[model samples]
Target: MPNKKTPTIWAIGDVQGCCDALQELLNHPEIKEDEHAQFWFAGDLINRGPHSLKTLRTIMQLGERAVCVLGNHDLHLLAVYAGIRRENKSDTIDEILQAPDVEEIIHWLRHRPLAHFDQNHLMVHAGVMAKWDEKKTLKLAAEVSDALQSKHWQKYLQKMYGNEPNRWRDSLTGSKRRRVIINALTRMRMCFEDGSMEFGSKDSPFDNKSNDIMPWFELPNRKTEKTTIIFGHWSTLGLMIRKNLIALDTGCVWGGKLSAIRLSDRKLVQVECTGKRR
Candidate 1:
């Protein structure tokens, strides 16, 4: 019996393989399937961690009940496996590429939303640009989502392997334009004090080498600060619990734990991920 309260939806962080941990987390005693429950995954379903094939299969089985956004890693898997991206030994997309249901998996993955999760909160693989107000962010997300779904999607994916547009502007051009939007929705980590998106700072939050920069959540004039955000992809930031944001990547591939949070009441759920990127 589905509950009339719209089913307690939980948003989970990156699961770079870590299938065992994912099973454990989903099977947690508190998450009762008997009740109406839904889940939203922040993305990065494959690569780095082991058993990506198993992980993708599991997520696919969940069907419409699960809402997942596209993460950089997930995109990497699709691009490489599809021959649009170069193969890196660090990623585990081969397993997924060689999987029996590869067609369905990639099709579904490519079609996943780049951003705009739900009403109260915006879901993304990584943090949003502190500069992009909700309106701009939504518009950018729509653009990328459109490109990914178009027949020229592979062209966009091939052109996606870069860090050129380090900052956002209203007048960027060509691939630069798409890259800025892509980076913001996918690879962004930190931002300068003035809100310029920083593409290279992957250190722990304490090591703020640049006094002018801070994590997206730590930015000063965040317009979306009032709107809750659910994001993954910052394994370095790990699981940070705050009123306005929820950082869900627990670094599962780096031997950290996989985290899931029930959005209805914000209950904590977790799985222990144990697999090296190699």
Candidate 2:
């Protein structure tokens, strides 16, 4: 019998509507050689770039070969689609909203999970709370996923915006509970000493001068510390690869390179991006 090839898994950082860079990365000689390669996108797949519509469609066309978690920009697109939030002047998702198959697109986007676990790695768009282990993190993420896919999804979207209940509490329920889960999984960057999320800082952790806040991954006793946690949404932190962590966002929309790393051997691939978010 011919031996079956082991599929290569490429974990990609935030595309952020940079379809040109994304396509280039996918077409890189090393990546294209593996016809059976699978892609894992660390979300923010659209918005803030010149090709939001095409970028989203490209990933959607990948079908079962792609695994994408939800990022904050993606969730913002949903909010704008739901009429719960208005688009900012810099937003680039108007094309997607006006597309003929917008309903289908929204359906697909909303159904995406906030967290994904595979290949012995746990992936989320932002950061995981110190209190939750892999199993608990997936469970909470699923709860938000169910709410987003439910018949009254808009209601959930309406309640989704907020920074309250920053700390994780097992007793949290309803929108407050979902809010915490969504914020931590999608928008979180730093946390107070108590592990309550801090949303104001978008700068790199090293640039953080405050003594009270620390990057979520650096928090003492993170449950997923031993698990290989792959994430993005922190472009300022750039490409960070560690024994137990992979931070892939390289600010593609801000003229940085689009990055992808092979999970098995940690092979890195990158493509330069023209600045799109001025």
Candidate 3:
């Protein structure tokens, strides 16, 4: 008998509806070369690129071979589908919203977890809170996931738009708590030293910054510091590979490369984008 091939897991950066770029990255010699490959997407699978429908379909078709966490854009798509929010001018998700399989696709996307952990790697679309250990992070993530899959999910989406109560607190309750969890897991880029999220900074970390705001991952004495955290929401921060954190959003929708990193060996594979979103 032939030797059983070990599964090779690839954590890919945000695709953001750039299906062509995703396909190109998948076909790269490093990725396609592995017959037993699995993919973990960092999220924002749709919006602001050339092909939202194809992107969602392709990832949906992956079934057991792919794991996706929800990102801000993903939630926006769900909000629009639920009639809780209007489509933005930059959104390219109309194809997905109008598809024959729209219901099925939305169901799949809505059910996706806010965080996923496997083999000691914690994956979220954005940063996990400094106060959350691996177990707490997973637990808090489930709270939002439950809300999204609940019958009253539309009600939750209706109240999901603001940035109020920007810090996490154990005493937080109801939709406010879920909203904070969703924002931290899907949209956070920077935070204050106390782990309260900072919404105003989107520039790369290389840019000048006040001492008061630091990247969420860099918060002092983070609880999840020991676990390897994989995230993708900050496209401007690009690809940052550190001892315990990976930031993989290389801005494929903005004409940057689509990136993927192999889990076992940390090999990097990338495909350059052909055009910027108009």
Candidate 4:
């Protein structure tokens, strides 16, 4: 059964290590005063902005009041921590990696869900493949989450990076299958008509479309079309709000606003952000 959502639940966009902005957003008069509000973060909690450690700590401290999905950057942090991947030049995760409670933080972060479903909304860091319905998306996300929490979690990280087998298939197994699931749920922006993803097009769907490329959500016959799909990660798309879709990444770490949506009423709350822009 889907968990019953509270009336004041807020779905927040990608934080990207913008702790100050997150603090500002939370301290908004309405949000701060609402004791009944619960937060559902659309992920990218850490990375590419200052205060990655502080951001993680703050969200971690939220406990049951906040639920966060794992974004591509968040997973990269784990892979780097496990020595399966190296930190890139633009990475801002050193503070998190070198924190005193780094291990504990990683443990908690790795356990976060890849997809969160409730109140008829499915939240992911990026796009869901056209093939999966709500149940299948949730189940596939769990498979990745389970691997992240397993004894050989590092092994999964080793295979986590890559863009292959771009299309989904039930028969796919091993690292190949898991890679496709992780890619679609975390890094995807555009996809072909056949459901194969396009990673290069990160601009607005309106300006970037050709005959073969379109936003994943715009795919024909998408099974999860009936359920509202909430996502972040495509900051260039900014704060997109449609009847059944919300793309809330407003480029907070890129000097844009940090955005949130009150799920019950679809009210938007935005906070101006002055975080470092890459």
Candidate 5:
């Protein structure tokens, strides 16, 4: 039987380590009025802003009340921790790396889902592929999660980067299969007409001057078109809400507002961010 008392669900945009803004949003009167409110973080929980450690710890303390999908930056953090990647100059995860609870933090982060599905809504850090429906998306995401949690996780992370095989194929196996899944679920923003993922564009789809590319969601005949997708990661796309899609990344780390939506009512709430752009 379903629990009749499920708490209010708030879908939040990327925090990008702006812990102060996140705190203010959490304490907003409308949100604070509900004692058992649940939070679904769209990812990039840390990086490129002040207080990565505090932001991560704040979410961690939420325990069962929080659900977070791993973003590209989050995966980059794991790769760096595994010594397979170097920290970028814009990265703000060093404080987390230097924390005494670093090991625990990494363990928790690696175990976070790449996608989450509940109440007919699917949430990912980025976009889903045109060929993938909700079930297949969850299955593929679980495969990556299994790899991340396995004893050979570091070896898997080592093989995780690359832009090849930018299109998904059912025949894809091993690291190639994992890479496609990771890229689609965590890094993808735009796609070519054939539904192949494009990694280079950071511009808003409306502002995209190219004729050959379109935002992944606009692809025709998308298998998950009937399922609402709530995602972040493309801050340049800002906040977009449509019948079957909601984009919540509002560039919080770039000094834009941190946004959130109450799922049941689609009520929007936001807090202004003062963080500097990287």
Candidate 6:
């Protein structure tokens, strides 16, 4: 019989180009040196902070020991890098795109899964749709992964960016279909009472009180009730501690701090973020 793989993991939140903060987090004492740790990122490793290339290279070097799901910012990085989109004047990913190791980093990043799972929990960039659960998600994520890893994938990645079909259904098609699924996995924010998701809600808890929409995790009778989900991409949601959900965005891109929670012991580690992209 094969020996069981030793389990050690640190499910970290969005890096968002915060290379310094990421360094601090990785060097944190609780990370445990003796154990072979597998790092899982909620993604968004570039844009809006700084040192995008350094951050990407560092993770790329880690290779299979680390896995990052696609965040909205990560998709944006790929888009800009692939010439499907242009970098804004305020963006800093050019450092990554022009780095000597840029192609290698992008190659690994472009192939990253949109969701990952091990024995205990599932990790995604934002939130998963209620209907798919973790197992189903990993399977579907593989489908998308195969699409991304294909030789002609640049066209697919370019095709895979947009927001339509706000709710999941069995019958969506073309780029619009792919884009909606991608957005939900990587960029979801709020949902209505009837379980319909809202793409327009980036507000903090105190920002709005219309009472018609709430964060997906806050929705009553959530479908993935039995599974613990670790997610980021909603800094507005901040550091949340729930019974089965770990929300670790921590506003790291908005002058907040980068955060990582040790899954073995639920230890939260953080480093102050300057929040400036340069």
TM-scores vs. true structure, each candidate:
0.93, 0.97, 0.96, 0.97, 0.98, 0.93
lDDT of each: 0.82, 0.94, 0.90, 0.92, 0.94, 0.80
Give a tens-digit lDDT track for model 4, residues 10-120: 999999989999999999987999876889999899898888889999988888889999999999999999998888988999988888899999999989999999889
- Decreasing lDDT order of the candidates: 5, 2, 4, 3, 1, 6
TM-score between model 3 and native: 0.96
Q: Write the per-residue lDDT of candidate 1 for residues 214-234, one digit (tens) a residue.
A: 887788888888889899988
lDDT of 6: 0.80
Residue 226 lDDT in candidate 6: 78
Candidate 6 local lDDT, residue 45: 82
Candidate 2 per-residue lDDT over residues 93-160, each given as its tens digit: 99999999999999999999999998789999998999999999999999999999999899999989
lDDT for predicted candidate 3 compared with the true structure: 0.90
Each prediction's RMSD to truth: 2.1, 1.2, 1.7, 2.3, 1.2, 1.9
Q: Which runs of model 2 end up more than 4 angstroms from their true locations?
A: 1-5
Query: What TM-score should be assigned to candidate 5?
Result: 0.98
The Cα error of candidate 3 at residue 55, in Å, is: 0.5
Q: How many backbone clashes does candidate 3 have?
A: 0
lDDT of 3 at 11: 99
Winner by TM-score between candidate 5 and candidate 4? 5
| Candidate 5 residue lDDT tens string, 99-207 | 9999999999999999999988899999999999999999999999999999889999888999988999999999999999999999999999999998999888999
Query: How does residue 53 of candidate 5 score in lDDT?
Result: 92
lDDT (Cα, 0-100) at 42 in candidate 2: 96
